[model samples]
Structures are given as C-alpha cells and as structure tokens.
Target: MDVDPAASAKVVGNMPPNISVCILSHNYAHFLRQAVESCLAQEPGDYRLEEIVVLDDGSTDRTLEVCAEFGSRIRVIPLPHRGFAATLTESVRHCRGDWVAFLDADDWFAPAKLRTASGYLRTGAMLVQHWEHVVDGDGSPLLPDPHPGGNTSTIIVDRAAALKLLPVTNEKFFHVLDDLGLGARMTHPLTFYRVHGDNMTDRATPGAHQEYMADVCGEIAVRLADLRITPPPWASRSALRRLTWHYRAEARAHEVEAALQRGRRRSAWGPLLRELASTVLAGRNYRDRGPSIHSVLTGRPCVRLAPSPQEEP
Candidate 1:
C-alpha cells in the first residue's frame, strides 16, 4: 500500500507504538458523533494515537457534515459506494499508523480498548480482538453472547498484514487462519455494539454461521490437491458428536452426513447436494459418524495431546 511516508506518522527514538483508527460509515450519521468521540476519548496507555478518520462510503446522509462537526480533529474520506470489504481496502491505503483499528459507524470503542491493544502489539499476532457490549438504540444494555464474534469493530490489525490481504474480508478469514498468522482474543475491556433493529445478526437466517463454515470447508477442499494427512481421533466417529458443542456448523453437519453416506475418506469436498437433499428428507444427524471437515480438508490438527503413558514406550 505505498503508504505515502509523508502522510504517515514517523516514530522517533522514544515514541510509543502508534495506531490509526478507521470508522467505516454508510449513512449512519445519527450515530457517527459518539463513535468518533469514543475513539477520541481513548486512553493511549502504551501507544500513541496517530490519527482518526471516517471512511464514508457514499452516504446520502449528512456524514460529511458530521465529520465537519469535529473540525480538523477528524479526517473524512469520501469514496464511491463500494461494499464493506472494498471500503476496508481503501481504509488500509489511507492509514499511516503502525497498526490499524477498525470501528463500525454503529459501534464505538471502550476507553481502554487501544491501551489493551498496546499490550498485545508485541505479541506477534496479526490481529488482536476484544469483547463487545451489545446495546439497543437507546444505549441500554442487551444480553451479549458469552464470547465476542471477533467482529471488525473489535479488531486492531497489523497494517502490513492487512495490506497484503487486501479486500479485508473477515467472513472467510478466521476459517483460514492457518494461512495467516495468529489472532488474539482479549476477554475484557470491550467495545460497544448497537442493535438499532437492523443489526446483521437480527437479519441473518438461522444456521448462517455453520453454513458459512461448511462452505469455507468446501472451498478449501477444492483449492487443496495435496491435502494428504491422517485425521486424529476428534475427526473420528467417537468424537464427532461434539460438533454443536463447539459451534453450530449446519453446513459442516451436511459434509459429515455426506461423508457418512460415502462411508469413506474423500480427498476433497464436492457437491453432496443430492445426498444432502435426501438426508434432510430422511432426517439424519451428521454428528454420529462425521469426520472433522477442517482436519480432513485443511490437513491441520484440530487438537494436540501428549502421548499417554499406555501408548508411550
């Protein structure tokens, strides 16, 4: 991303790690102010705040006017109406901080968010994600899930890594974490998520997450011609029932059922569409004899355990 050195912040001998915060907005002008102010109020503990900018993606609302409200403190970038991933690509091009933080126009950061991120800056992780407090339009607390979704608004990524990936889509990202480096999960000191009736979670159909995982597994299968390895016990029938215990992967369930239908190991994923349709009609449970789709397809370990005394010679 040829980060125009003239525009990026230069760190001298004793300066702390610096970060650029990017707020992605698309007509959420009503919520823009608090979002920007929340970032401005961040307590830069071990890091320095390089800049704060709004990547406005063709908002017909008074988004520019909102940025203008902050005077020179906030930089407003106006771009054509591209989708979120594409706008994220532009956001990387505009950042000068050593690290880049993302926030949704509908979300805001906690006071300690960046400070918490600074502690993890040297941990060699490509991204550091924290928890989120979900609230309604009135700013009242709503019951949040036990774990954060590792949403964009909760993430601060290494600028270089982000640039290399481009498009910046997290949808298939964590699914392919083996290709990228490590990602961290910070349990405390959260960011904020507002559910203004139109939240994506509210609109998504049931089993969406699991369906996505299944599709990702299927994609990995097609890309991999050399994925040869023995799946561990967890990929076996004995451990298969634990599927939903981890995450509700509806599509993975389908793949497992397909494998069970085949009754053998497959080199890669394929359209089990016909068999899948039959299974849904026949009422089958995929957990009984399903292999770990990730392990079988990606050839990555699902779990590592020490050799038991009974097996150690």
Candidate 2:
C-alpha cells in the first residue's frame, strides 16, 4: 500500500477526538490508504475519535510505508499474520476509547460512518451497527445482505460486558459466518460490516475451507449449548432446528469435500443442501423459538425476543 505521503499525513492529522478506530490489514497497500482516509473523513462533531490503531499483519507490500507517513496520530502495530481472530483480539484489548470501531484492510468506511455510529452509541445500548455497501473488486455496489443498508456498522456496547460475551475477534478459528455468533447475542443494526470478494472467508482454500466451516458450526453448537444465556421458547426451537440442520450440513460437506478431491464436481445437491442448512440456522435470530424459513434466505431482520441469549451464538 504505497500511499502518497502528503495524503496520508492529512488523513492522520484530521482524526476526531473521542473514538478509536482500528484498522487491520495484510499486504493490501493499494486499499490501505483509502481505508484510512475514509476513517479520517469521519465527521467529527461532539463525538470525535480519540485514537486510531492500525495493525499490519505482516504486509510485504508498501503498506507499512503508508502507515509510517501518518506519524503519531495513528498507532502502528506490526506482527506476523496471526490470522484475523488473534489480530483483532489484540487490537481490541489494547483499545483505549469507550467506543471502538473496526475496518478491514480491503475495506474503507463512508465519510459519515463514525459520525452516525457515535450518534447511535449515545442511546446506551450494548451495540448499534448499521448496513454497509457490498462492493465488487472495482468497488462497485453489489448485493447487500441482512439489512438492505448492509451489516451493522455503529455498535456501542459496554466494552467490558461485550468482551465477557466472547465477542468475535478476527483471529478466532471461525470457518464461515463466524461473526454470526457475536451478532446473535446483540440486536441488529450494529457496525457496518462490509462484504467483498477478497474478504477472509472468501480467501479460504479449497480442501481446508469446508472443514473450517464445519468446525465453526460445531463449535457454535457446543458453545451455545453450554452458554448461560437462556433461549426463549422460539429461540429454543430454532436452536434445535439449527442443530438438526447442522448435522446434515456437516454430512453433506464431507461428501462435497470427498467429491472435490476426486475431481468430480458432481451434483449441486450437496453444496446446495449445505447452504440451505446454514440459511435455516441463520434465520433462528428472528423467531422466539425458531427462525422463519422466509427470513433465513431473505436476510430480513427478525424482531428479537425480549429475554433470550445475551452471549454471542
């Protein structure tokens, strides 16, 4: 990420006063400067950004050069790639502000991203995230999931409480849809989550990808089962339904992997079924006991039950 020094300095010097923005990147110098500029462009009113932390996970590109140009306005932490989970965990643990925000290396924020996020945070809820724009490699808008606006962007939580819930860090060995666990615990409309082709999940290698996803689902099952949070009647039923679907999903996943290994792309049923199963489980968020099938595939925001699980799924 070889950003022009003058532009980089301007962005860093303009950071607001109360919030802290954390950007995680790896060899994405081309996209790093834009992301930082976006953060710097945030409207700084009464709610401002106090700190900005950029974690460079072993970028072999000019990404570090661009970061260095920012001087002290941003804290640059460089380390080998520990994967997203560990890197994110370290970043959050080191955050000093009451409100923290996340930005991926390949993604950039909208100018109003933080301004809007901080406004919502004032509500005193555990979180407040909003929709995001899904873009193509060229940055064109693509189909947005969950809410039409995008993934939740401005989430304000009691940092301590949110952490206790085992919030999703970038390095946790999540397979696919790993963030669902943390999102499940919190209500909709939290941070603006960007979906791009080069995202971590999209980068998963062939043979290893399927297994990683299976691991994520299995871990969620075990974690939710033992969590202290109680599921409402609907949520309980939803969990059971998801549990059933997960079992079948895993089975189909194995078959898909086996078929792929044999160089036989074969039929679509296996992969299609796996996706259907994941879709079903995701729907559980809306129902009191089980998620409606309609909402699952459609990505509609379901009304959360009054007293259900508080911890991430």
Give the TM-score of each candidate.
Answer: 0.64, 0.58
Q: After superposition, how far is residue 244 of candidate 2 from its true place, in Å?
A: 14
Give the worst 10-residue stretch by lDDT in candidate 1. Answer: 225-234
Backbone clash count, each prediction separately: 1, 46
Estimate every model's Cα lDDT from 0 to 1. 0.61, 0.52
Candidate 1 lDDT tens digits, 1-313:
1122223243233456689999999888889999999999998597889999899999999889999989989888999988676777788889899888989898888888888777666555566777788676766666545336467788787776565444444433432231233455567646887767544341223333434456644444332211213222213322222321222233445454334333433522443333334334434454532445544454332323322222221
Best by TM-score: 1
Worst 10 residues of 2 by lDDT: 304-313
Model 2 residue runs over 4 Å out of place are 1-18, 143-158, 167-197, 203-214, 221-313
Error of 2 at 1 (Å): 38
lDDT of 2 by residue, 12-44 (tens): 223332567888888878878877877777766
